[model samples]
Every structure is written in structure tokens, then in C-alpha cells.
Target: MTKKHYPLFLLMMLIFGMMQVKAQTSLNDIKAILQSPYFEKLYSNTYYSLLDRMRKDGFLPESLTGAYEGMYCRTTGAMVSLLIETSRLKEAELNIKCVLDATTQNDMERIPHVIGIKDNKYTIISDEHQIDGQAHVLLAWARLALKRGHTNFEDKTWPLVSAIMKRTCDRTFFQHGWWSVEPGLVRNISFEHSREGRRWDVWDLLTQSFVGAALNDMATVAERRSETKLAADWRKKMEILQQGIRKNLTTVRNSDTTYLEMRLPDSNGGTPYLGMGWVTLSPVAAQWEGLNHQVMRNTVKAMQQGMLKKTNGLAWMPTDSYPDGTVSNEIIGKGQAWEMEFARTEKDYNRIKAILDLIKIVNAPKPVYMEGGWLDGNGHKQSEKISDTDLAAMNNAVWKTKDAGNGEQCAWWCWAMARLRVAAGLPAEPARVK
Candidate 1:
């Protein structure tokens, strides 16, 4: 590198060095990424109109009182808060109140394990549910209450968070931050391929990452505002969780990109999402926003090739799954569009731009407004829309292209879009795909 390029090279080296430290989750890097104009514009525009569409579709009723709607309590709640963050508080408030009232009615039902059935109330906490589902609910309420200075909401939300954590500790096995649940017997599944002697626990990556993040966010908020008495304890717990995540879920760094673990290290040497990058945005965002920003950035860059865009122009981790060698597979990799966008670093903005351009060209994957929210995929490969509306919405969504013949653009996608738009400083021009 030339003398003039020395600073850039050195900066990259410094970020890599930081990721090697003991506590590897970098909160600061995430914050810096979020602050970038590219992210702001992309996120804001993507999310701005999504809330309006969600409200219109009855997915979010004005009643402010309802049931659990399956394990989607978290997605629903998180979307509401994201909407509010992007200046859609009126809509967000309605959704938040609905969740609160629903949870308040039958607190017992809202625990985890409430999957597949949307009774509008709540479900049971079993092995089937992703832990992050519950965490999302807690985070949604906590963020809203804290931001709005609502003491009562904070009070209510904290207990729920604590209860969930305590229950998680009670039900699952936690040793040195490594958690494993006894499948089938514990819930009901074949634990055919667990760690030999260990319980046949189907470790879901999304839950681990999100649960850790939700706790950390809660802790950070607590430390900042000290809104709840549990802030200190929560913060300590968060530190423990972070340590455990790093220990058990050691980051897989390849070339210049990094990825979190989904399952225990497999010998195949392919990506083991096990749900790792499913919520990659959270930890990365936390690191950037938290004190350890540099660590987060370096960690990402060091592992996964730093978010590559295909020659055909789609932002996704390069894999051999597709005939063209681009599509990200859910079973093998869960190569979704949001991951491509969210994983973009400052060094990889061009790649992100290419992917965004493809999305626009396709016109934003239609069937835009549905009963629940965004549809899951563009190709409808996982077309369980009516049966698994939450899953569909959780995975699908876009800005300009709604009807790409895949499925409806849903809430989770909307949330992703809004966040990206906000980061990019773009106009929040709402477009429909259906």
C-alpha cells in the first residue's frame, strides 16, 4: 500500500485487532454503521410506509388489546418500536398497546414455546419456541417505554423480561453460558444428532443471538436511564450472556468477513446459520451503539468476506447453492435479502447498492399488503403464508418491488427497509408491491 493508503490499511488492521480481544462483540462499530447516511436513507424509506400498511391491513388493530398471535409477539412488538423509531409513533403506540393488553390479560400464556398457533392470546413455553420471540416482546415494550419516559410501562416490561430469563434458566441447562435443552422429552422432537452425551437440544441461532441482544439492549437502556431497579442486575447478566455467546458461539472469520455461529461447528466448512445471521443486525447494531463498536466491525469484516454482492447484483453471502452460484439458502444458509442489506459494512457499501438496485429492478417483491404484513419470500419457496403468516412476514418485505411473484412483503422486511432508509438519509416515500 502507498504511504497515502497507509492510514486506511492501518485502520482496517486496528479493527481486526480489536475483534481479537477477549470480549469480542463490538457495539461501537454497529453504531457507526447505523449513523452512516447510506443506512439511514435505506432504512427510513423502507420502514416508513410499512407501518401504515400494517395498520391498514388489521394486522395492527386500533383496539390496543388482543392475543399473542403465536410466537410473533416479538416481531410484532419489535416492528412497532422500529416504526416509532422512524417517527411513526401514532401507529406504533396502537400496536404496542395491543401487545401490552394482550400480555396483561393472561401473562402465563405469553411465555415462550407459543409457536404456530395465533390464538390472539398466548401459548405455552416449550422447546419449540425460539427464545428471542419472547425477548423481542420485552425489547419492544422496553424500548418504547424508555423512549417515551413511561415509568409504568417500564415497570411492567421489566418483570416480564426477568420472568422470561428466570424461566429460561429454570427450564434449560446453562453452564458457562452454553445452553442445551433436552428435546422430545423436554418438548417433543428427535434429538438424533446432538453433542453425543449432551441432551438432544435443537439449538436455534436466532433465539440465542436475539436473546443476548435483547438483554444487552435492556441493560444498556437500564444503565443509561436506570429506569428499572433491575438495570444493574440485568447489566451483569448481559455481561455474562455476552461472554457465553463468545465462548460457545465463537465467530467464524473467513477472508475479510465474519459470521456468528448457528450450530456447533460442523466439519463441512460451509456457513452454519443455524439462525446465526438471521438477527445479525441486532448484535452489530448493539456493538456500534454500545461502547465496543470497533470490536463488532472488525469481527464482521474478519469472518464472512464482508458482505459480497453477486455479479448479477444481489447483496448476499456468496455460496454454491444456486445454479448461478448466488442465492442464499435457508436450509443450507437461509440466504435472505435482509441479511444481504444488513451485513453491509462501510467498506462494502457498493455491494449493498448493487443488491438494492436488483430489488428495485424486481419492483420490490409484491403481494405487498397482507392480513398480517409482508409475505415471506419472493419465490414463495416457503409458501406457508396462511399457516405461518408470522414466519412469512418475518422473512419477507421490500420498498419499491412488492409483487415479484414470490409472496407478500411483510413486517420484518418493512422494519429492515425502514432502518436501512434511515441510515441512508433517503426520503421515506412509501411504495406498494402488491
Candidate 2:
């Protein structure tokens, strides 16, 4: 590779270094679970029932109010979105209220990344802030509003949105007219793949895309409420963000362009996302306004060839990796939300089906039910060993590790299935599946 072409080559090298998990699950042998009657009835029914009880009993964790220092809580945005999609409007609204009520002076600090679940009550389990988590919660609010035609709970919901954005006055909330790329983009500066508090200048693709989408959605709310100036400002800022993302995040591979992870101000290269579905979930993948089409397609190609699992082809992406095919993650079902969303957005039927085949409960040969998500393969290098399972046993070995698991109905697994239903022209509700 010559000097001019070495950057893309090196980017590909960084991707190829991701370890391909030896999935224990058989990709071809995935049962016709999506076509089954039990998908909406038996499996999901059982899972959601359990989740509701957990919420009532304080056994489950809420994403917004509960987060740990060393962990990533990705479920809130998706979780809230999933809740709204399932006709659980009241429940979804209650959860939204719990998050909104915390906009006070003392509560604003905890607002960005507070963690915990409300079990008939509210609480905080972790105080660590994750920009993506904040973006997700914001996105969730937007989605819920859109779904509700932007009404019904405006008394509380509107106040919350107004308050959060109003914090731009306070340095703690956002900057005044902080709409420019350099000074305006809210910098949550975080690390992907649980780098254990490693800080990179914010504006990473994952957070950028999510935050950008959220901003646009909020602009819609502003327009509806007749906040014309605010709406216009938001749109203009979103355009600038769009320009910023393209300028900072795009890279070339084999002359095919794609977006890179973090584009630090003085960085030589950008970070690649190996943690399952973050790439596909990028704003580009979401097909949000202002993304480069070639870049998006190239991104899908790069991930499928280099970042995704080569073993079963359906489990998950690597948690961490280098140029030597080393990896440290297993199958995470929720990550599939982006995978399925990307596939649907790209109109790739085959890719969409691959994701659905995994979520189809019956296709899961293992005895486990969906919780967070399940593995298609084992990551021996990625996780610890259990007493019953040998050093490399894959699925049931979860008692000894975190970061990988089954897809529970109330989590990303179920949410992904819902997206698939839309892609397949089926009812979004799994229960209505034929």
C-alpha cells in the first residue's frame, strides 16, 4: 500500500483484527421460530410477564435512573422506544415522568447519566454518565412523542423537554447557541465497548448519530408547540451537525467510503466499533438526514466482512479487537436492534431475515429464555468460565460473566423482532404474528 492509500488499508486492518466468535448455535439450523404461533404468544408472553413482575418487585433495572461506573446501559432509549411501540403507553408515560421529574437543580447533574429502575417507585442505582445513554433517553422521548401524535401526557412530557433544553442557559445543561460544530456539539466525551472510563472527545459516530436524530425529533416538537425560532435554530444546528459528521467521520476503504467512529480533533485515525451493533446504529445507518449514501453502504460492507461474526454469521459483533483477529465480546441480542434497523433501512431482505431467525424464540436451541440477549457463539477469550461449563462453553455460562446474554422480550431482542415485523409486512406486535 502506498502512502496515500495506507489510511484506508490500516482501517481495514483494524477491523480484520476483530476475532470471529465460534458460535455454538447453528445459523442454518435456526428453527422457523418467526413463523411460529408461539413467538408472540408463548415466548414473548412469558418474557414480558416476567419483566412486568420484575418492575413491580424491584428486580429489574431501569436504564435512566440506574447505571454503574464500569458498565454501559444501552437499553433505556431502546427500552422506552420498545415500551411505546407495544401499546404500553401508560407504562411508558410513567417511566417518562420518572425521568422528567428529575430536572431540578440538584437533579440536573444526575440527569445526564443517572441509572436505576422504578418498581412502583423511583431510585438511582448508578451515577455514571454515558452520552449515548442520554441520547438514547432523548431519542426514546422523541419516538414516544411521535407515536402518541405528540399529545396525551404533554403536561409532564412537554415540561421535561422544555426544561432539559432550557438548561442550555446553565453551563451544566448546554451552551447558548451552541449549534456550531466546534463549540456547539454537546460533548459527553465517552468510550465505547466499556473502555472502563476511557475518555475520547465526544462526537463519536454512535453518540453523534443518536444525538443528531434526537435533536431533529425535538425540533419537530418545537415546531408543533409553535416555537418557530427554536425549531429553525434546531434545524440549522442539525444541518451543521450533519456537516460536522460527514467532515469528521467519513473514511475511504478500497475507494468505497464509510464513516469512522470517533474523529478526535487531532487524531491520526478513528476508532472502529466492534461492540456488536453500534456501527449499524450509527446515524448514517439510521438513514437520518444528511448522511452520505456511499459511506453508509460501505459501512455495512465493512462491518459484515470485518467486524461481524464469521462463525454463525448471526450472533453478535466483537466487543474489542485488534488487527490480529483478537476479540473480547459475545452475542448480544439487543445489539441486533441496529442490525435489523440497518438491514430494513438498506432494504436488504436476506440480512433482515438473518437477524429475525436469531430472535425467533423457537430457533434458539438452548434452554434459556430471552433476558438481555443470547449468544450465537462463545467468546472464550472474552469471558470467564463457569464451574459446570468448561473453560470455553458458550451459552449457559452467563452466571460467570456480563455483557452477553439472551434477548428478553422487554429488551432489545423483542424490540428487534418488532422492527422485523415492519420489514416483513407483518404486524409489529409479535402476538399478532401468524
Candidate 3:
């Protein structure tokens, strides 16, 4: 068997082992996991750190010293919600103000620019032809508007979002069923696939994920405003996009086992990010097979065997691939791993617990306060603060990390996973109880 196939077998065995055992989580159990001092500290630190970064640097960057402002809002919004849910509403409100402040300072709209706040610190480098940033920008706006009940909500963001979505739909890149960044500008500039780069032509899932999230937010906002027609229209659009996602979904097969493929346009016909099998846990995914008993089991089993790091607790980023299927010389896949976890069923509690355990481990030694923490849009660390205390102690402190530019996009992934687990009938976490 090939090297990849070996892991699949082991994963299958792990799943089998689970089948003979009962899931050990109750609602209180899940809530306890969420409220655990370790997990909460990580959540609070990372959420605010990004805000502090934005205030200090004036623009969120994609990394510690990198410049890419287009994608920070979504992460920012995601973290905002996390702050609110965790009873840190005041901090969340402050971060929202910072982003809005930055937007005004930058003269940015829904198609948020990628440069810095003053004197063009760096030219924004993107294909200059796609909508992940645009979608994320809208997602952030809608999230803030909805959560805060901002009086100027429509007057403030609707126009920008409307124009951007209209432009996005008009793009040939998106119109073409595959949904890609425009070709011929710069390979890997955005998540577009083209022959220009010698790199493997892998489709980026974040684009779709962001778009899906934005649509959901838009629909939610429309519904709240009692704009039934608008809500219905947006919901239909989301459904269409989601349906397309399902129709195109495919899995990678190695020998007798299969792993979910992270990117598409499967340029090499090989599963590069085998670790992405968890993404399928997206409850709202168009092609979700989560309702089926066996399929759910398969996913739970996959988590047990394939992605769970035996020693670290942190989940792997897609298989071994970097951004795309490109053979990176650098081991970019390594890190403390953030708070995101996949949830296909309540039965998958063990997997969730494992993720929480890892969060404890990663945050234990260097936990910071719940203040503005920063990680890029994808939730990897930037130059965020790190202290000497263990994760438990850090839970009570406020972080002051520079904004990595991604505000809450990182938090949204974890938030969605948590909600999904609850939706799957997982019990409430114990700690959330009054």
C-alpha cells in the first residue's frame, strides 16, 4: 500500500473502535468544554488581540509583518461574535468600532482595499479579480450591523455590499461554475487556479466558505428587517450556491478508504490536504451527508484516526499542502493550531474534546488576556502577546497583540463548529449554565 493508504486503514480501525463505544458527551459536557478556562482564554485572547493590532498598526495584516487588508474584516466579525457569546460584549463592541474606524480611515468600501492606512505601506497584491475579500468584508459588516443593531446599518454598509455582490456575480471567474480567481494576473495572488504558475492548480475552499457565510449573513439580516422578498431572494441565491457546492463535491480515494479533498479542480488528481477531511463537517455545506447514520460515523471515525494529532491536540491544516497543492519547501503546515474543530454529529464529542484538550495545551503555557488578540484570517498566529502563565491563568487577562488583519474569520469557524455540534443534538456545555 502507498504511504497515504496506511493512515486510512488506521483511521478505519479507529472508527471501528468507536463503534463499540458510546459517546460520552451531554449538553453540559459540551458547554463545559466551551467554558473551560483554557478554551475561553484562547478565545478571548485571540479575539481582542486582532483589535489591538488594528489600533496599533492602523490596518490588519495577513501575518505578523505582512500586508493584506482585504481579508481581515470577516475574521474580525467572527471574533466579535465570539466575544459577545462569551460575555465579553464590551470588548467586542470596542473591536467593531476599531474596524469601522479603520474603514473610515482607509476610505474602504465593501471591496476593502489591501494596502495599509497611510502612504501606501505596500501595494495590495491579489489577482485583483475575485471576491473572497469582498464577501468577507460584507460578512463582517452584516455581522456587526446585526449584532449591534446599528442605526445606520443599511445606510452604512448595504450600498457597498450590494455593489460588490453585483460585481462578483457579474465576474466571468465566478460565472464559470468552478468559481475561481481571474486568471493571468498573478498565480496564487488570490485563490484562483490557472496554468500560469508551475504550482499545482488547486482550488481554494476559503473563497467558497467565505461567500457561503456572507450569503447566510445577508439572508439573516434581510429576514430580521422583515424584508421577506429580499430575504427570500437572498436565501434562494444561497441555496443555489450551496447546491452547486454539493453537486461538485468529491472525495479522494486511496486504496479502499476515502478522505475529503480540500481543494478542487483537482489539478493533480491527488488528495494533497488529507487533513481537510474535517471541513466536510460544515453543517450547512451543500453536499453534507451528515444526516445519515453511517456517513456521520465515517466522519467521526475519520476524525479519530486521520486528523487527531496523537501528541499535540492541534488539528492538521489540509493534508501536507500549503495554500494549494504546491510543493512548498517550507513546512508551513506546522503551528499551535487554533480553536476550530469539525462536528459531523453529537457522537463526535470525543473529537471535539480532543480539540479542546489541544487548545488547553497550546494556550496553557502562553495564555493571554481576553483582550484584542490577533491571528490572520485563517487563525494562524501573528506577533500576538505571549505571557509566562499557564493557559488557566491567562484566561483572565486581556491580550494586546497586533491585529493580524483577520478579526473574527478565525473565530467564525470555531463558532460554526460549536453550533453544528449543538444542532446535531450534542448537549449544552456544563459551564454555560447559570
Candidate 4:
């Protein structure tokens, strides 16, 4: 921990100073954030929270006993990363195998979007298939399997991943592009944690980031297996994905800057919130790189102009921007946390410092109330109001923003475990970071 650490500083102290820290983060400073009181609390509390929920039946229910109780496919991979980073080898292997063992086959995809745990047995709970679920798992599997220098684990797991990630047996996507979820549609399709209606499918900055990371993971694993041809192919795909995103999905904001859109332009043409969000920041989780990633530097510049809010303490910027020309006010801690890691990836010390300040303000680990992020157009707090009311009974006066819809709790912020990994110099699992 840094000698400068204090457990009780007021959250507002750095509200102004954080912006001035444009300097790069030293490795020691990164270690300091990792060992800081906030990180320790975030790491241990969240890990235990998930550990307590790990059922002997080999499933980690979304909630111990609540309406939202079930398994989300994305959590497992991020959880596996947590265990691996912390040296919980057996436990990590158990979770990885648990998820693989329970994978149910669907014509649509092998990896189910949601699974329900009941009386020690888990079953598919939804028809939905999300690319993020498969991406997170593949990334985790690749990293852990590589660390052990063995292909047995991947050989065992590959059948399922291949099925889920497979675009065509002919491997047509190996050249052009790939989807995040399987039966991988290239048109409007429902995706993970999205309820605003089907957006463009096939690819998005959000899903492609993770999928590209997975491709790189597979590339590394293939290289390790001495499958040079396969590794080269995977590497090419990863590059294509990353470069494609850098090329097609960004807009020249002005002569001096450019920013990535939330997803490629949808026919719907909704929300200015599109360009500046987790959609841009979330890509920091991957090993994929471009000739230059100035897109993020510009993104941080654009976001700071408005997005990151200060109510209830300095919060990460809200999730979405609406068509009405207003950005969200409610803070989503998971998004904030992951964005902090994104800053860490870029060595943006000031952003990381601001986010750590927020964890202290909100008492993140203990109860994990993801501070509401939807803001009134006037910059007043509306996160709680918007979250409390989902689609059907929205408030006329309230800002329209949809949250993760866990009226109860989001499995004690299981995502925190992985964000901690990113803070510890491991890559973040984008989709699962939430």
C-alpha cells in the first residue's frame, strides 16, 4: 500500500485534483492501488461473497435466494480469472469444470445465457445466447490452461468452446470477422444485458472487444500447442477484429480528436449516449492492440466533459446516453470499476484515483449498492428512481435508463473479483466485469 493511504478520507477531497493527474502510472503506483485499503476490501469481500455462494453442486447461483437467483454464463470465466490470479487453483479448476460440465446444447448455441440452480442441479433458464458469455469463458480457459503449460484442459474444454464460438465448420469467419455469441447472427439480435430491443448483431465495439481478446487467447494457446498455422490464423482474426473496430466504429469528433461509437451505427439511430460509454472503455480487457489506441485517450477526454458524475460521491459515468440529448446520472459501480481498470490499462492514474475514491464513498464491498447512475437532464440524481422502475411503469418525469434489473443484488458483485485482477496487472474480462 502507498504510505499516503488513509481509510477515511472524504470522497470529495480529490474531486478537483484527480483531473490534473495526466501522468503515467508507475508499476509501484499500480501495486499501491492493488494493495490499497479499497482494493483489499474489494478483493476479499467480493471473493468471499462468491465463495459463500458456490454450491457443492458445482454452480454459483446469481443470488443465494432471490428472484434474480440463477447462473449467468459470463460470471464463471471472470470468477475463474479471480481464482487463478489469487492462486486458488483447485477452486478455479472446479468452477471452470462446473460450468463446462453443465453446458447445455441448443441449436442456437451451446453456452446458455442463463442457467438456474435448483436443489443441487442446474438447468438452462433462458433461450437467450450472449456472445459475451462464451468470450469470457474462452479467455479464462486460455489463460489458466497456458499458465499450467498444458492442453489437456483446453482439449477437454475446446469441444464446447469450438461449438459455441464456431461460425462455420468451413471457418469462413476466420477471415472476415466473428460474433460474440453463437448461432452468431449478423443482423439485429438480443445480446447480453441489453433490453432496449435487438440492436445490430454480428458485431459491436462491446462484444468484438471481448471476442477479439478470446481470439488472441486462442492464438496464444494454439501457439503453445505448436499449432503454428492455427495460431497464425487466430492472431490474424484478432487483428482484423481490433483493427476493424478502430477503423469502422469511430467518429472524428473534431479536427483534434475522435471517439469510438457504442456499436456500429444501428439503423435505429438512437442515443448520443452511443459514442461515450463502457462500450468504448470496456475494450481495455483484451491483449489485442492497434497501431495506436488514441481512441481511448479521446474517449476519456469526451467522458470527463460530462459523463463521470459526482453525486453521492464521485461515481463512474453512467451507462448510457439517451436520444433526448441527456446522459445518465445513476452510477453503476461495476461499470465504474471496470472503467477504472481501463484507466489502469492506459496507466491513467487520475481516473483510477477518482474511481478508488468512489469505492470508499459508496461502501462498495459490504453491501454493494450499485449507486444509481441515470441523471436528470439537469444533472440531478435519478439512478435510484430509474432503476426502481423498469419498462412497464416508468416515471414520466424520470430519465429513461435501464439498469441490470437486479432489484435485489447482483450476486454480491462477483465481477469485482476480476476487476481486482485487472488492477493486479491481469486483463479484465469485459462482459463479466459487470
Candidate 5:
């Protein structure tokens, strides 16, 4: 009741009110950036523009002006996810048909990593049968079916989905719950860090996480469709896979949990740690349910400490740990986008803003372009130039430094931005082409 006590009470109330205001301002600030004209234009240009380049058969090439040819299944699957999330149901359906059409015309039911057109027919370009690619496509199908409210497996995509599940379940190599990446397979080419001619026949965390997630998705679809036995089988496989990941692919030291990039097949093999890059981020990126929250936090902490870098004051995560034991300083566009999504999930507002700033800066000078441009470690663009008309016509998806865009990178970036918008409580749907 004293005047002195009243002053103290009033000051406390003032501090609490200021704290509430600061929290609201933080969220509002994020929303403002996401809703800005610049951000909206970037999303529209990356998305609808890329869709404009899709082939009649639904084949979206890896790059527009770059040296890439054919359709990468994994990339196409990413595009499918983007389309479905944006409510482009018709486009998503056509893309799914493209994937089914590309499936090998054999009993193996194998889906090639790259399917190219030859004589108006789909030909296998790289037949590595990557587990993650398979997972991506299967997950895409499950998502599309679920989104369309198909609860009885009566959708046109059901037959293909069933065949893929059967093939996956029948693979002898996958009998152990988690499959290993075979040595000399072309799948290594898609992995940024493992592309340097490394001999690998080991269990990789990326593959495990993706496959596990896909299994979960498929199981949900099966459960909804009243496929009780199939759902139970898939749930069991997922549990085993999760156990395998935890028992073999994770390590702990000084109370800090670290997920290994790949576990050696044999006991005598060396340590599985690969210096923290995409592989380390995969578990969280896939949102694997088996992962402990503390483990995800530790993995993010490791990436921030080891892989985070800056160029011209813009933040990026450089590609790390080639097979030759050397690190790269190049900013793989897709990798940065993946990290951006992760940052948004973790609510690291500062990290998200830094990445957005980097993207805005790199893409600001949009007229000139190149195919497969070299973005060196120091965040410099090194590639020959093309005209603005060419870029507008092609509307490539991926932008690596100054190189002509690729579909995979563009899809990933757009997907990340879309997620950011949703997080900011803005519209999840991107602006349609005018």
C-alpha cells in the first residue's frame, strides 16, 4: 500500500507489457517481409515460370539452359510436393502420370534416377534405383492420394502405388529394415557431399530418414483405406528402420548427440562421421519421428558451428566434406533452401532473415544467366552470361549462383518460401500467373 511499493508494481507491469509488444512486433516483421512485393514476385517467378517450361508429357528437365537432360525423379517428386501444397491438383496429377510412365517396363518395377526421351519413348538414363528417389516418388503418390480424399484405394494412382510398395517390400537388400547405398551407383551423384568418387556401401542417414518417412506416409494412406494388414506391415517396417537408425547411425560424445552421415557395414570400418552437412540435416529435414528433439537441436547446433558461413555479409551453408576428405565453399542453392526451412521450423528468426537476405542479394541481378555456373566458396559467381529474354523464356527453376536455373533447386526454394509464408500466418497459396 506504500507509494514506493506502488511504483515498483507499476514498473513491473510496464516491463511485461513491453515484452508482449516486442513479441508481436517480431511476428509482424516476419509477415511484412514474406508479404512484400519482392518476395511475392520471387515466388511467382520461380513457380509459374517453371511450370511454363514443363514438357507436354509432364517431363520437367533438371535444368533449362544447363547441360542437364532428362527428368530426375527426385526433382520431379519435389515439384509434385510443391504443386500439391499450392493446390495445383491438375498439374500434380500430370506429374504423377509422368513418373508412372517412366517406371521401367519390366517386372522389376524399378524407377530410374533419370528418365530421358529417346525416339518419343522413355529410356532409362541412370538406373541406379536410388532408395531416396523411390521414397520421394512413393511419398508423393501417397500425399496426392490423401489430398484428393481417396480413402478406398480407388484412385487411378493406386495401382502404381501398390506396385511400388510391393517392389519395395520384396527387395532382398532391404530385408534388414534399412538399406545401404551400393558402391559405384549413380545415386551418389545427387548427394552433394558424396559426389567425389567415394567408395560407399554403407547405411546413410539420409536414405534411412527419407525411406522411413515415406513408409509412415504410405502406412497412413493404407490405414485410411482399410488395408489393415498392409498398414500393420508398414508400421512394423518403420519401427525396425527407426531402431536401425538409432542403434547404428547416431553417436554421442560429451552429452552432445550427433547423427552420422553413413555407418560402415562392418565393425572394422572407420568412423561414420562426415563433418556435418546435408546428411546431418536430413533427419530433421525429413521430420523423422524417431529423432529425439534434443538430437535435432544438437544436430542444428553442430551445423551452425561447423558449416555456417557468410559471403558479402549474407549467410549460407557451404557444401562440406567431399569423398577426397576436402571441403567445398560453394553454396548449393537447394541445400541453403533446405536449411532455411529448418531454421523456420526451429523459430530461429535471425537465421531465416539472414538466408532470405542472401537469396535476395544473389538473385537481384536477374537479367544475365549461365548454365552450371560456378559459385565458389567465397560466395562469388563464376560463369558465362546469357540474356534476360532467354531466362524469361525458359523460366528455369533452380538458381545456383549465376548458372542457368534447374527445376530441383527452384522447386525446393519455392517450397521453403511457401512454408515460411504459412508460418508467418500468410496465405499458403502462391500468386497465380497473371
Candidate 6:
């Protein structure tokens, strides 16, 4: 070969070798982050705290540090997801049973948002039925049952599962191919919009996406049990829901790119919401099956372009503001964790590393890992403390937001780290405690 061509060939080989090295380095970097002392301490502390809060009836408080006294079904479902991801199947099942027990206490077939304990008796705290909360709990149960791989597990849970499906599929809840937040229930419009003044009726993307996801998951379980007709029905419902989501809740921007709306206008005269926040990315973050891959990619791209910002030289996403000018933007820990999960799904190792670095930075100042709550854009914790009057006005029980670490935030961060390890070809286990 000529000397000139030989030099070019050698350069090409050098570039290829460097790429290989970078790939290997990326895997090692993820492993080091997972194995770091800070990660181990946070995971261990949070895991034990969750277990400690488990009652005889399997109730676990939403957060030990916050005014979170009752067992919030949505938060409990997320904890169950974390437990299942970390291979704690028995614990996950226990939590699912707790949710089922709470769900059946009413004749309306509606799952209460929060279940509290009074005088050693389980009591319904808030009857504000949330579609996504119900879906999350059901999905967690289905996932745990599937993971157990025992036919009897399915048989034991099928009755409760069927009841939930019956309620969730009821026309009052499932309207127009998408699940609607109950009318006049005064539910939070979205997780990010929880502080916004009361909304009696709303249709949120998180609810729609999660309901579709739950249906798909239940369909898988049904197919596993050879319930072909039921499985087909659920699948068909999911397909219709997906289509409705695309047709009604998506808007075309930049002439060709489609993005999902965070909330849709209700018959009660609510306006359509188009925002770049965590709620807007729920379809992808929830990993709903059969969604258009390009749509998810575009939605994430749009969100990053608009809502993604840096705090303390690390990346994070800010929650949206209320249209009525009640609550403004703030950095939320769980939202950032959700973004990290999406990054891990996309195999964006550099982005994952940046988020991990941010987590370390946020917790470095705290005595212990703090609950996933509000933070300023500058990375300082916001005062989550709620006054008694404010709690009463909101119709909530004592909700003293504590500065100390709690279970929900820890579970989210740990879940992300564990999933990242799995993405890097490691087992789905927490880091060894040092």
C-alpha cells in the first residue's frame, strides 16, 4: 500500500480503538457510581426505612419526613415498583395486598387516594379517586404476580385483579378511549400541579398513559393464564387509548414534530395544557407499550429543549407553574430521577453520569438523603413545611415536610441507580453496603 493510504488507514484504526475504550470506560463509570459509598448508604437507609414502616396490614407511609401520614396509593405503588425492580418480590406482593384491601373497602369500586390509620383501624383518608393511582397499583400487582412465576400466585390474585379491572374499565372511569380523572373529585391535576388550587374535573396525560400501560401489562398476565378473550379485549382497549392519545392530546410543533400535551380540556371548560414538564413525558417514562418510538423521542427532545436546566453544574428538570399564578417552578427530585431513567433507557451514558453527579451534589450538603420534594433552581432545598391552617385548607392531615431523608425519594434514586446498573450489564441489585 502507498504511504499516504497506510497513514489514513492507521488513523482510522486508532479512532476505532479509542471508541472501544470509551465504551468500556462508560460501563466502568456506571459501575463505580452504583458502588459508591454514598449510593450504598442511601439505598440501604431507604430500603430499611420502607420496611420499618410496613404495618401488619402492609401499610407504608408515603414519606416519613413530610406531612405524608397516610399510605398514598400512588407513592406506595412506586415503592412497590422499586421493590420489584430490586428483586424483593415478597415485599411487593405484600404492598399490593394492602392496596387491594384498601380498594375494596368502598362500595363505589373506587380506590381512595390515601388510606390512613386511626385508633389502630384503617380509615379512608381521601376518597378523591385518581385514575393513575389506581392504574399504578394494579400494574405493580400484575408485575409482581408475573415475576413470581407460580400459577397459584396468579390464581390467588386474579379475583382482586379482576375487580380492579372491572372498576378501571367501567365507562364512568374509562371514557372516550382514555381514562378520565373523576368528575368533581377535586384531585390534583398532575403531580407537578398538586399545589394548584382545587380542580374538580381534569384529564391528565399521566392518567391516560398509565392506564394504557396498566391495561397492556394486565393483558400480558391474562395471556399468560390463557385467558385469550380477556387478553384480546384489554389489548384492544389499549390500542384505542393509544389512538385517542395521539389524535386528541398531541399537537404538532416545528411543522412536523408531534408532542404530547400534559392535560386535556375537560367538559367542565378546562383548557388544553401544553407544557414541557415531567407530566408531558409520562407516556415514554411509563414505558407504555406500542407507542410510536419516534413520538417518544420527539417528546423527550422537546422537553429537554424547554424544561431541562442545570443546577450546581448538574442537569435537572423544573416543574411547571400554575396558570392561576399560585405555584411557580422548582426542581423536584423525583422528576430528575424520572429523567435519569429515561436517559438510561436511551443508553445516553454521559447524561446518566451527569444526573448521578447531580444526585451526589444535592445529597452532599444534607446529613442524610432527603425526601424527594421541592428544591430551588440553585439546588437548595425549598421549605416544604406546611402550616396547620394550610393543611386544613387543603383538607389534608398534618403534613410537616421534614428536612430529613425519607423513603419515597430514596426509592426513586435507588431504583434509577439499580436500573442503570442493569443497563450497564450488571445485576439488578443495590450496591454492597460498605
Clashes of each: 78, 16, 35, 12, 4, 2
* Off by more than 4 A, model 5: 1-25, 104-108, 151-155, 169-171, 175-200, 266-271, 321-326, 367-402, 432-434
Model 5 agreement with the true structure over 1-434: per-residue lDDT tens digits: 89879999999999999988765435467778777777777777677756888877787877766667778888766787788767887777777677778784533475678888887877787877576777777877777777887633336656677767756654443445223432211122233233343445556777777677777888898888788898898888777776666766777644787776775555342246555566666765565645676777777777777556544455666555433333443455666677788878778777777767766666666532111222332222333222223223333223355444677778877777777888888776776634
lDDT of 5 at 11: 93
Residue pairs that clash (backbone atoms under 3 angstroms), model 6: 67-399, 67-400
Superposition TM-score, candidate 1 onto the true structure = 0.57
lDDT of 3: 0.43
What lDDT score goes with residue 338 in model 2?
Answer: 61
Superposition error at 50 for model 4 (Å): 1.1
- What range of 10 consecutive residues in model 4 has the weakest lDDT sum? 179-188
Q: Per-residue lDDT for 1-434 in model 3, tens only? A: 89989999999999988976555664557667666666555545544454456543334444433433443444454555455444444555554444455555545543443434446433333324345555655665566667667456466656556556555544333433333332111112254221222243343444555565666777787777776786676566566555544433334333323324344343432233444422344333311231233443454455444433222223422222223322211111111122233343344555556555543443354443211222222222333222212222333332123323233333553444445445544431213211
RMSD of 4: 9.4
Quote each prediction's TM-score. Answer: 0.57, 0.69, 0.56, 0.70, 0.79, 0.79
Residues 85-164, model 4: lDDT tens digits: 55666666777677677674324445666777566556678746565666777777777777777756677776666555
lDDT of 5: 0.64
User: How much is 4 displaced in model 1, in angstroms?
Assistant: 29
Q: What TM-score, to 2 decimals, does candidate 4 have?
A: 0.70
- Candidate scoring better on lDDT of 2 and 5: 5
Better of 1 and 4 by lDDT: 4
TM-score, structure 3 vs. true? 0.56
Select the stronger candidate by TM-score from 2 and 5: 5
Per-residue alpha-carbon lDDT of candidate 1 for residues 1-434, written as tens digits (9 for 90 to 100) = 69999999999999888777733323344445544544444444444344443533224421112222333345554465456646666565555555555545555534333323255543333434444456556566556655676455456566655565555433342233223322101111222211121333333334455555556666666665655766666566556555545544445444323334333323222223422333344454222222144545654453244333332224333221221222232211112344444454443554454544544433333322221212234454421212223223434443232222111123555544555545555433343332
